[model samples]
Target: MSEPIRVCVTGAAGQIAYSLLYMIANGDVFGREQKVILTLLDIEPMMGVLEGVVMELSDCAFTLLTQVIPTADPAVAFKDVSVAFLVGAMPRRQGMERKDLLSANVKIFKVQGEALNTYAKKDVKVLVVGNPANTNALICSHYAPTIPKENFTAMTRLDQNRARAQIAQRVGTDISNVQNIIIWGNHSATQFPDVANGTANGKAITDLVDTSYLQSEFIETVQKRGAAVIAARKMSSAMSAAKAAADHVRDWWLGTTGTFVSMGVLSDGSYNIPKDIVFSFPVEIQNKQWKIVQGLNIDEFARGKLDITTKELLEEKEEAMAICNAN
Candidate 1:
């Protein structure tokens, strides 16, 4: 049998993790033949809840399951883990300002980052799934100096999946028909879900759908889809977010087969995006590494949209810098 892959998940008792844990155990992220040992973490108060989660995982009788460890200590949870999902963060509550939210989460990520630096495998692949994920990832990366910055990514696959589904619906086709859709910038309202360079059933998306709707309604819908889910479901998106998180790590671990997927990775000055900012861009994964898809022409409209999102990320970095750098 192959050696077991150590996978760590934070916020193990939360909604997204509730949906995500089973998928990971079932070999949805790692391959079916791969054995996995999960190290799950949460706050001390949530440790009992995490224990219940472990009990459920035990009941599943997954053939590839090796073991499950539940703990409140980040160091213990992260130790020797090859893949770490930094899925826990402070959620935005009613009446909480943006700065307050940033401040709260920055501290959480800072501690986790330090623990990861001290404990996780040198090549650990970390994906931040929590809200304001791009900035949270930035803060985490800033503290984990031992881990390669490129190994740290934020989840933009959710946004990309939403964009792909929207285009597929507009074109009256399955989502499998849409290819190369890009979710650029932060995973916020300013995110640019571009379909201009994408295709639906081997034809350019712009040729298949109304350009006006693509630019306006389609963009708005994808940006606000999370809020819409919250309003209708009385909670934030759990299943889709969980699935997206799985897909994000799966594609990064396996290769993307020369396809473009959206990932919020540290900027290397590509498209003039500032270096070290965790920004989403069109990328192709190969050899377990991501390279930004280069030389794609950005029209004036796209440029304007990118600028707005970039400005927001920059402001977020500045707002959280004091907290992020304190470690």
Candidate 2:
């Protein structure tokens, strides 16, 4: 067998981690043929919880899992890591200001960026799943000058998947038939789920669904799905979010030759999005890096919603920059 791939996941004590670890161990992300060495990283206070998670992994006896290492040290956890999933963050409390949240996460990602630069594999691909994920990914990518900017991405596949499921339900078709749904701009409430270019079993989505319904109801549902989940479950989305994270990385590392997914990445001026903002776009993975799918015509409606979501991303970037400058 080839040498095992090293994968590091931060925030191993959290709910998403709880859902993600078993999946990773069972080869749900990397495939059964690829042996994996797993590193679980968390704060000192959560070390015990991480150990418990490790114990559970041990019980599974996963043949593809070579070893499991739990650590509180970034350098140790990220050492030689091929894939880094940054999931830990200071979540926004009921009244927490954007500045406060940004400042706190900046410190966390800065240290992680430095550690990644120093210890991860030369080709390490990072996916930030924390809240304000796009901005937090920008912080890490900006700080890690050694890592190619294209190697850093934030999770928007969740939004894309959610859009696909919603469209499938409305069309009374299996989700397998839904294709080309694009989630534009950001991962938050302002995210634009564009079905203008999407299709259900090769039929244009716009032809099947009312354009107004797609623009208003469908878009809003995809954008606010996270909040809706939280409201209903009384907890942040964990299982589905974990699955999305896995799918994002799996498609990235494994390649998306004929498929497209959404990822929040440093913009290259696609769709007139301001450069350097980590915004979601339709992308395909090749050679373990995301290349934004360009030249898609954006209609007036799609363009308007894209602008709205991109503006939200830009504002978040500004908030992060302000906090960094203030400190």
Candidate 3:
């Protein structure tokens, strides 16, 4: 048999890690044909939890899983890694400033980036799933100057999937029928889920549903879905988030040649988004890299919303830069 593909996940003791590890071991993300060796990375305090997770993986008796290694050090965890998921982050507490959150994450990402640059395989692909994912991804890409910018992306696929599911429910149709829905701009509250271009079973979403209702209520629903889940369950979103992260990376590496999906990628000034800032946009993955779906004609309304989301990304990028420079 050939060598197993190495997959490294940071923040392995967190809730999402719990959901993600099983799926990976079962070949949910990388496929059954691909044998995997899992590397779980976490902080020193969480190393014990990671060990427990590894024990569970061993119990599953998954033949496709070659090995599981848990570590607190990025250098060791990322060594020869084929894929890296940056999932551990400092969650923003109530009353904490956004600047503080950004700064804290920057410190973490900077170290990871340097480690990845020095240790990971040349073909390693990175997905940032932590909060302020776009900005965090930018920091990593910037620090790893030799890695291609297209190799670093943040997870906005969750937001995209959320929008699709909400639209499907509203239309009384299955999610598989939904297409062309775009998650524009930041992955945060400012994300613009453009159903204007979306279709359900070849029917325009706007034509089937009330455009005004979608613009007002539907958008808010998709944006606040995370909060709603937290309110109901008294916990952060983990399972769905993990699933989305898996989908994001799977589609990226596996290729979305004909289909478009949303991802936060380093901007090349597409749609006037500032260069180097990781912003969400409709993209198609080909040739092992993400290429923004360019040349789409944006109406006035879409343009306005897109600008709002891009502005937030730009502000966050500036904040991170300022904090890094000051320190």
lDDT per residue for candidate 1 within 18-127, as digits (tens), equals 99998999999888888999999999999888888989999999998899999999989999999999889999999999999999998899899999999999899999
TM-score of 2: 0.97
Candidate 3: give the clashing pairs: none
In lDDT terms, which candidate is top? Answer: 1
lDDT at position 94, candidate 3: 94
Q: What is the lDDT of residue 7 in candidate 1?
A: 96
TM-score of each: 0.98, 0.97, 0.97
lDDT of each: 0.93, 0.89, 0.89
Residue-level lDDT tens digits of model 2 in 29-124: 887788999999999999988888989899989898999999999999999999999999889998998888888999999899999999998789
TM-score for candidate 1: 0.98
- Candidate ranking (lDDT, best to worst): 1, 2, 3
